[model samples]
Target: MNGQPFQTPVEYLKGVGTARAEVLKKELGVKTLGDLLQHFPFRHIDRTRFYKIKDVQDDLPYVQVIARVTRKEILGEKHTKRLVAQVQDDTGVMELVWFQGIKWVEKNLTAGKAYILFGKPGSFNGKAQMSHPEFDLYGSEAAQRKGNLTLQPVYSSTEKLKQFTLDSKGIQKLVVGLLDQFAREITENLPLYIVNKFKLMARADAYRNFHFPEDANKLAEARHRLKFEELFLLQLKLLKNKVLHTQKFKGAIFDKVGPFFNEFYAHKLPFELTNAQKRVLKEIRQDTQRGVQMNRLLQGDVGSGKTVVALMSMLIAIDNGFQTCIMAPTEILASQHYQTIKSLVGDGFIEVALLTGSVKTKDRKIIHQKLENGELKILIGTHALIEDKVQYQNLGMVVIDEQHRFGVEQRSKLWRKNVIPPHVLVMTATPIPRTLAMTLYGDLDVSVIDELPAGRKPIKTVHLYESSRLRMFGLMKEEIAKGRQIYIVYPLIQESEKLDLKNLMDGFETISREFPLPQYRISVVYGKIKAEEKEYEMQRFVRGETQIMVATTVIEVGVNVPNASVMIIENAERFGLSQLHQLRGRVGRGAEQSYCILMSKDKLSADGRIRLNTMVKTNNGFEIAETDLQLRGPGNIEGTQQSGLLDLKVSDLTTDQELLMLCRKCVEDIFAVDPQLAAPEHQVLNMAFQDKNAGLSWNKIS
Candidate 1:
């Protein structure tokens, strides 16, 4: 069965000697008949019918001719022999030529015999000719064999394989031999209703015909079934992961909001919290109060007041006699969060501490000791928060800003800092689209701060062609003269190994040469710099000592200088829409009028043009996120690899927005009735989920 278990390639199957088998393994990755059977065709050549000799043209690559072999001649040396045969049909006469393989042609073609020759038709002296055309031998039964050619599948071949004469026909022969003993695995994954409703072909038959199809209809059916299965399985795996998290993991619940919230609201902070902010805070308060631990994502647009919400939540943790830690991607962001809350939090009640990798040894020891004891109420730091030495006495909640920038496993390490896993409140300035949020962070409850605080003016976005660079510089000079800071950003820092750096670096040098403001200073930052150096440059800009900051996207997420009112992003076409939006968010932070000028070269792609135009039209981050979802699709929107998010099959979180909504509805219903998918109709989904992820069930920490 299946050709005697395929021990050695040469002895395992027919037609393959040691020499040919070695060549097959080396050149085609075909070590056995099994490999040959699975080597699928990229595309097929349709030969349902052929054109007559008279109808054939040089442009066409195939022609049919009922030609009589009027003459035959052999030429060339033994090593490089050639065969020339002249044939005439009812339409016209043509020469059939062959090189290197003349002996084979000579044995097959007999003079004065009528045969059909199929190949590329060309011209020689105003007459039809074919170079190395495929021919069938004439026999007494040739009359019965005359029929239309059907679609022929084409297999990719290398020169070595071709030299062994392993053409498409040879592959077909191998497939036929293997199929004689074929025992297809029966897959009963999708529900019978789903299969019937979708008009899917039987799984076993689909696999068989997918490799070797008899007709176009069968091939189409096979492809549809396979694609559907691939997508469905992928989605099932991701969704099941979320289900496992919900059922298996236990979290620390801190649901009481009265004590800490009452004190903060009684003070009636200077600025008012928007209605959207109040609603989200309420959701978080309720989730924390629940018996199970709270894992929630607080998604807000740029300048939507997310920091304040996080601070309030941390206060609740502190009031409950537990410690809280806020982690940011960069030291600057962490320090910024600490500074923003230090005054509002009104020190002494909560012993706030900051710890970073660069902290002095003496300071580090004190901070470590304070954190180990219950002396520290609230702690803020970069990755230093997750360090082994920095143990929290009673860590109850963790607030991570720009949460997607982290590895999910790395973030999980912070939860282990406490005896009981801390209630995680992941916050993001990036406005995640609803579809993406449902799939990527499906395990976590989500809250959105959709409204912006009053009196914060929307940034005015504009697009300019590179030709307007000189005028744009003049405008920037005027803005700088008025004591307003400007951000001049290039796509890259230096010349890249692959890309041309002439644009970005050249622009940087030109700016240094041209605009030399005597009173104000300029700071530059990029990827090549060390972390400390980046912090130093950003600090200079933040302190108002530097009015112009020339940087790349390194400052896109971090380095919030509210005083800066002008943002100029060069070669905007080179950046993605989301990135450009993030860069735009850097400005428009303060009360002053902010402008974002996107400069691009001519000839923008349709997608790029839409991205730039959308930026120019909208100021709402949610609207921009929705547009980003529509344009970039789900992969970039949710960032699966980095997010450790669920992989959705058959569902594009963007294009399949309606399907996502439907899936959400189904999730609610299933949880209501059959939480574990144990119902009869859902049995297939349950088994499919169980059968899948068998090997990947290890704890995420490992």
Candidate 2:
């Protein structure tokens, strides 16, 4: 690391002294010469050709041209300087106006002489004119292009910094001068086989071309190579972390389910478990008993019966005399899970306690005492479960519902609660794309329930334009007449805004005024409302006290009202595909034929159209999730990369799904043959890994 050149401050560069270096540092965060080399361009403008004045549209941007300055006129006095220079081409003559800097323009634009001018062409008073045009004498593409970067790298800076004369050109000048004296070629970090196979440019060549390219093609190639390396290194780091964690942690052994599972299976409750549920449970059982801590991700579409499998696993832990704690994102979900498990397990004195932030003072104290004493075996709650005070005597397993809703730190806190971290199981009803699943949960062993429960009905999805509002209402009335409750959900403009959409409120008012049933109550719930109020509204809908519920996406994740058969998503184009699927999952929980009406405005983008079409085509959340990944790519799912899973650049986990399979195969093959990458051919692999994990590495390379 110390051997590399241009690692020193920019002030030490050949052309850049203290003054310019201070401006560079303050403006672009480029204190070192290395920083300038890494500052890649946002985009580039092509000035390879000059357009004719006649050919240039009024709306198009103008370029430098050799034109005669026909006439010069001043329109304003001293302080308010206004001047115009009419420059003529063979085809036409356009007015070049300079409102503020007229004196400088007049001196340069001598009448009857050719001068180059650049600006945007605009029509004013039926004549083409440009404001404060950039002009130069005796200039052409070949001559002016030498010092300027071929790609024209745009550095990010603030307004104040720009005022200090630390612009892109200044940064470029400093970089070029430093590189001449200090730049030394570094060893290529990729294996020779990979470089040849991918036809990637050499690492040093890529770095040079990325900063000061001779052609657009070279610049593009350089960018692609760099982006690929960045993503690969990040992935390598994540995968390595997972490997280290698995090596260090050993989980509780639950190998023999002979007496416990056998007795439970003998009675078999009333109905048999689905093949999918059985398969997932077996996977979890195998993983848990393997001695290594089971960090498995359970992904299932809604109605796929993920909860049953989770419960069965908890039962296995409980039967083995180990306590289990299930954490939910919401109190309502916690309460619901507690009810389902209590009835299903029915093991008297097993001690299942419900703990949430909303629990009363005395009740909370009692729950806390019970948890600390190890009397509460399967304690379920929201984040309050990990609230410092809640202690488990023998916490064997931890199940997290809606895994994305919780922070990474929050999850880690729960794992370290016990001496030996509990075997972690993250459950999500929102099915993730397979490639994403690997990258995101590369650290965890993943088990999925792809098959839906046998008796569960598939929700029928339909897309409708806003023009069909009257027809949609008619269809809703028909569904309502059948004694089925309807949920009309409004999409929020922004996730944070409590009252962006009037649709939720308007829909509530409409139901109360127009569609009110004497016995069929209507309830409204949104993000603005208190959590207790939200729960109350959900409870009413659940207990069948409220026949219709008008709400926003607040009910997207945990609200489970099976009786609600109709889901009308207003302005569906505004919502993402995964979100729409989750909201649709809310309905179809019951037996009656469920339908989701996606009411989108006619004005929809191509991606928007695809999203709506994908929803209509399938009820499978995994399929929709895959489509969503393809459409949106993997920047951030559920907004702002909450999962911290695939923060990839060039590697599209969605589109590069097949390529990832190949990469995984390669990883397996390499690890199988040479676990430590110590082989002769793997020298470059070591280099790549070192570059990728530079920040985390403490090992010295000798």
Candidate 3:
């Protein structure tokens, strides 16, 4: 194992005990010696500047000062006690306070002694204060540094880790110890040619300098090398998986579009296929015809007619003596899809049924039987489709709607339902940026249906503050006068769920007062409402029985009502851009002109303003998604939280577009020639591609 390179457990390290290692593992996911080494510092502090106490401002993040302690005391009762010390620079004196570890701090603080004090500055009762400041005796190692030579790495540490003396300084010591012992053990993982071409720092030196850099330039180089290496490893894994999958898996070939497809395209088709939809259908049909299993991701903005493309693909499967299923993340969406497909196909065109958690036991058994006997040609459902008892006959393909909601394991379960895994067509309404799409779904071929259906008009979006509630009411009443429905949604954040529910109720009350219930039927829905109740309320709106629906973000994913021409999102600033776009998509489905009114409070953050502005600015989900990625970053993007692929240390998907593209191209170039990386020069690259995430059933996040 090359002297057990990065695999050794942290407990075996010189200074780490079992307790400390456990804390490290729990808090930092640092199970192995390698994890510890790769735990790059969050930031490197340049401890070269000293400021006068008089110059300290509360707005400053941190300030360092050369000061002498003039007074020190412990105050308050035992439980509420704190250690407070006054330190004086030549300009002025500032109070330093420590809430915890007061005894140890009080013991160390000495009056009439000089110290190097550093911490965030704040004002308490118009006097300067520094809380829990880090200090060292003046002229000690920490206080004697000058310029970049004084750069100190600060690792992230949890309170639990701190209890075991495994805070940033403690973690640093362990890393330093490990580096001294095993720095020579890290061999170059990259091919020598590629390394020379990129002029990347050696793997060993990069690891060392990542934790403890020599200078700003070396630190920068080390950071770039590490980021490049991480992206390279990820791309290598994805590209290799693609090659191996193509070679090993066989797909069901639906070579002909037969009666079901022909008949539907001839008479049952609801609308003329947009060019984008037709192009996507062609791509899917081509994938299914190939001997290799098709793994394609279909990206479309809302109302882009992707469902028709998916249905046509399914019809082809039926004609080829195969079965297909569509899995939506929500029951409401699944039901809507069932209704849409049912209406599109007309009566008895093909056998179809809805399966969900609420399905009756007897009906579920019947549906299961139909699926097993190949009587059900198409099944539309939620995650209930993936249950162990739910079997499919000749399951040739599976289409996952809002594919991000399902974990990789669950998706793979559906893929493996057949003797040979079924072809997978993953569809998402949320737009992904080009670079992120490549990184997240690197193994799947992607097709984007960028064009919306004809006769659909872009929903006019406008921003309004709370002061304009009366104006919103006027707009709502005007839309209702035209026999149209309206949707009023509130933010439902977990931390402030009570406030959110209160807001929703208050909105309902306000609307109820404006247009009394006898004159206007209004329905309310939120996460706290019973599932059946929520469904009833949503179905009322869907059926045009309710002129206005008061709800929370639960309506974001599903609940289609084309007649609902107006959507008012209260506290619109609370939502991310993708969410705002999705909410806006609920309207604009009907041919009639639609409107989305963003209602936010006066105090909007810069990003909040950007989000609301973007909604008003464009209907393009891709553009909205790019803006979202830039504002919040990749890690916080909709479905990427659980994706270990985004556990990037230095590389940012938003800003590292150039680097990501370069890495992808380099990997693709190698794969095109080697296919298996069999050459001598490529062996190091192959060897370095260790599956650290092995033994995981849900290996792929996509």
Q: What is the lDDT of candidate 3?
A: 0.87
Candidate 2 lDDT over 1-702, as tens digits, reads: 123454567677776778877877776666766566666555555544566677666867545455778899998677776897788899887888887766677676778777666667787798777788766554556346443223455555566656655566555665566556544644566567767877888777777777777688998788767655554454455555566677789888886675545665666444578888888888998888878888889988887878778877887887776788899998768887888777766776357888888789999988878877877778889999888888788888999998878987899889888888888889988788887777767667788888877677788999998788788778777877787788988887675465555667766776677665684578888877887788788888888777778888888876777778999998899898988988898888777889999998889999999999998998878888878877877765663375544534234566566656655655656666766678898776665554422221213210
lDDT per residue for candidate 1 within 262-339, as digits (tens), equals 777778365889999889888878867765567889998888889889888888777777889999988778888888
lDDT of 3 by residue, 575-630 (tens): 88988888999999889999999998899899988898888899999999999999
Backbone collisions counted per model: 4, 0, 0
The list of candidate 1 runs beyond 4 A from truth reads 1-102, 105-180, 197-199, 212-221, 265-279, 343-349, 429-442, 445-451, 493-509, 528-533, 602-672, 679-702
Instruction: Give the TM-score (vs. native) of candidate 3.
Output: 0.84
CA lDDT, candidate 1, residue 328: 92
Against the true structure, candidate 1 reaches a TM-score of 0.78
TM-score of each: 0.78, 0.82, 0.84
Any idea what lDDT model 1 has? 0.74
Candidate 2 backbone collisions, by pair: none
- Which one is best on TM-score? 3
